[model samples]
Target: MARTPADLLADALRRDAAAPLLTDYDDATGDRVELSGTTLANWVAKTANLLQDEFDVGPGSTVALALPVHWQTAAVLLAAWSCGAAVLDTATEDDGRLAEADVVLAAQDRLAPLEEQEPAELLGLSLHPLGMGMAGYAGPARDFALEVRAHGDFFAPYQPPDPADPGLLAGGVELALGDLVGTAQGLADRLGLRPGDRVLVDAGTAAEAGPVAWLLAPLAAGASLVLCRNPDPARLLQRAAAERVTATLGVQIEGIRELGRPA
Candidate 1:
């Protein structure tokens, strides 16, 4: 039987609980955050609980993601899948597809524009390192950071996700949960990612390559991510060395093999 994305995450949690799963850096903001497999799973649990309890998201439900490639974005995507819901990529224009989502999770910057769409449930994420609420913004949407903290650390979904259910909705394409896992694994293999590989990626490339490259590929390969946003080219070599990056996706670094491309 083909495993679901959630299952893969769970396996990572059990196998490498203490290993660093994600190291996020935003050079433009001078912000950095690292999450271990266990910590990442805990965040996923809390977000999943919030989705299932507050919004009644479950199998067949759709959650539109309007955020960028940040650490919090990973939690939101995993949480939606944990609740047996399909994740709709709203980063790209898709006509009226976003309007059909049961829930919309957007960054604070996108609230005003999304308000016009009037989704059934809108959640605004601060994307702050401390997970704070949006400042001075009076909006109809719920605050994701504030609400997620109130949820439990561990999640046991009332109904587990079915492998056959739609897991991803992107630009008119709907991929099943099993298909998502399969493709992720295939991408990982094609990239020659080995276990324990540390893959460095830039936010621009992550956003452009979609979730398969930014998120699932690393997970499927048993590798970790060093996700950099607004990276300074001058400091790229230093950062890659500090992170012990074995491979790179978006940016080319000296002495590191470029994944999915010839060195």
Candidate 2:
């Protein structure tokens, strides 16, 4: 069993590098992007390198993630952990946690409120479908897309994080690196996730459930994801069929077995 998210990713690379790992769909904007295991790993490697080389992020560094449940968010989370840094998810900006972080990664639209707080380091993400840099905006934050490209395609942390070291800080929850991996494996089992399973998840649920449900669990179980944002009810069945979805979460599709339900 994997002891960290990075280990889970390495396992996937060895087991299914060519398989589709993430399929993101935004019903509101009609945007869709698919990433294979190799592609996702490449992004993760680049992100980890960016955090380590440019920002000097390593073991014990704390990164506040303020982005939505998108594919890029997954890469950021994995990269942070790979560097042995702790993640503080201020998705709701709960209790001004972002002020406590050593670095902040936020979407462009969320940068306004954070500007006043003035975190030591801030990286703005456009969340563009093509993963492009922010357009025509002068902000106090660095552009993630622009800086990330300058980093190497591989990462090697100067100091690897110990399994018992802190890995996440969310609200009142504090989890160690080992705890995150353990919980991920448990959640995967509870959801009946298995190799070759293409799990379809509602984006709203992914956001609400946090990384454990929508990210780590799938990786730990060796499964892929089809994350749907603002899914149209009328087209849900057709999409599921076309995607060959084998399991689901957050949406009640009659014939599709919901995760954790009795078989």
Candidate 3:
């Protein structure tokens, strides 16, 4: 049976329900949170439902995500993909680009300036645990956590999009849906990825090597991905040793520089 990218993730969630799919660190609070496969799937489904019901974002629609490296951002990306919508990962809030998207997902701090332009509908996702000082904010924005909580755990899966259709568009280049899946599969095969394997991804965003190498590849191979904000040599080594991260994606280094191994 041919598998779509979303299907691959769903399958992994079913097989390894308790496996850690995402681990995010909060530097300010000094807290580490892990979202298991099942929990991640639940959040993705809820977020997808909210997008579908509220914004009418589905097949052929595009959603712009302008957020930092956080768990909510990852959930939104997966949710957009699950809805068969193409995702535009951009940092800057360009009016022209925002005008083209069906919806925009951004942090609460960035919503004010975006609202002034009236480019597109905005949804605020708060990375901070506390909800203080966000009382009067308005303008087509919905709370990420509250919206997800409102939807039921079950979400009707969207039909898989055409493999040749556009999945992501960076700059002026369109990345075919099949190309994304193929790249993910190729990396997984080359890295000997398998079920139950934990892979650490040291990249920044979905537009970078993060999604394809860390997110897509592991999901395609029925494994899990660990996302890190900063890839410090010592921290990475420690996490790899403690978490038993079997595979890593990023720059190649000669020997173990941090470990004092001879080059």
Candidate 4:
């Protein structure tokens, strides 16, 4: 069993690197992307290297994030965890403390206000389905998509993260990094998640559920994820069928098991 976010990904790679681990669907743009376990790990490694080498993000560092529910967001999160850095997600927190973070990564749309906070270091994610650079934007923040590819696809943190270190800060609540694995397992059980289960979750629900439920729980359960953004209500059933989803969050589909308000 995985004891950390990094361990969860390593376990996935050990099990079947080629297996699809995360599939993203954007109804608004009709975008679909699939990431195998190996591919996702590679991204995580590259991003982790960037964080540790460039910004000196490691144990005792905090990375502030103002991004949405997306695959790239997943990579950034796992990377931060791999470095043993705590995350202050703006999705659930205030910009008042964003400037206190060592590094801040934000989506283009959310950049203006966060930029105003004058973080020590700022990076922008295009959130492109194809991992393209931010287009038609002139900004001071460095581009994450371009910088990450230059890093190696393997990571070894200079300072190993201590399990007792803070892991996440959201809604004024704190959780230690060591507790994440256990919390995820408990959430998985509450949601009735089983190994190899396919979960379909909408972006709204995922955002509300936060990373522990929408991201870590599925990983902890050894379940693959199918995340939908800007979900079109009419296509829910068809999309769920196409994804072979056994469980759903934040949406009701006939015959599919909902996460039962656990998220």
lDDT by residue for model 3 (1-263), tens:
44446776678767878878877654445656688888888878888888888888777889887777676777787788777788887767654686578888878888877777675577777765332224556657777766667787767745656666566765566665667788878877776776667666554643364455557777877777666665565566676767767655553323322111122
Off by over 4 Å in 4: 92-94, 261-263
lDDT of each: 0.89, 0.88, 0.69, 0.89
The lDDT, on a scale of 0 to 1, for candidate 4 is 0.89
Model 1, residue 20: what's the lDDT?
89
Model 3: residues >4 Å from true position, as ranges?
129-140, 157-160, 190-195, 203-207, 231-234, 251-263
Model 4, 1-263: lDDT tens digits are 22567888887788789988999999999999999999999999999999999999999999988899999999999999999999998673346888899999989777777777788999999999999888877878899999998999899999877778888998888888878878988999988898998899889989987999999999988999999999998999998888899998888888888886543
**Candidate closer to the true structure by lDDT (higher is better), 2 or 3:** 2
Residue by residue across 77-167, what tens digits does model 2's lDDT show? 9999999999998667533779778889999988888877888899999999899999977979999999998888887889977788788
Q: Give the distance in Å from residue 174's predicted Cα in candidate 4 to where it truly belongs.
A: 0.7
Q: Count the backbone clashes (under 3 Å) in each candidate.
A: 0, 0, 0, 0
In model 3, pairs of residues that clash are none
> Which of the predicted structures, 1 or 4, would earn the higher TM-score when compared with the native?
1
Q: For model 2, what is the error of residue 67's alpha carbon versus the real structure, in angstroms, after optimal superposition?
A: 0.5
Candidates' TM-scores?
A: 0.97, 0.96, 0.82, 0.96
Summing lDDT over every window of 10 consecutive residues in candidate 2, give the lowest-scoring window: 90-99
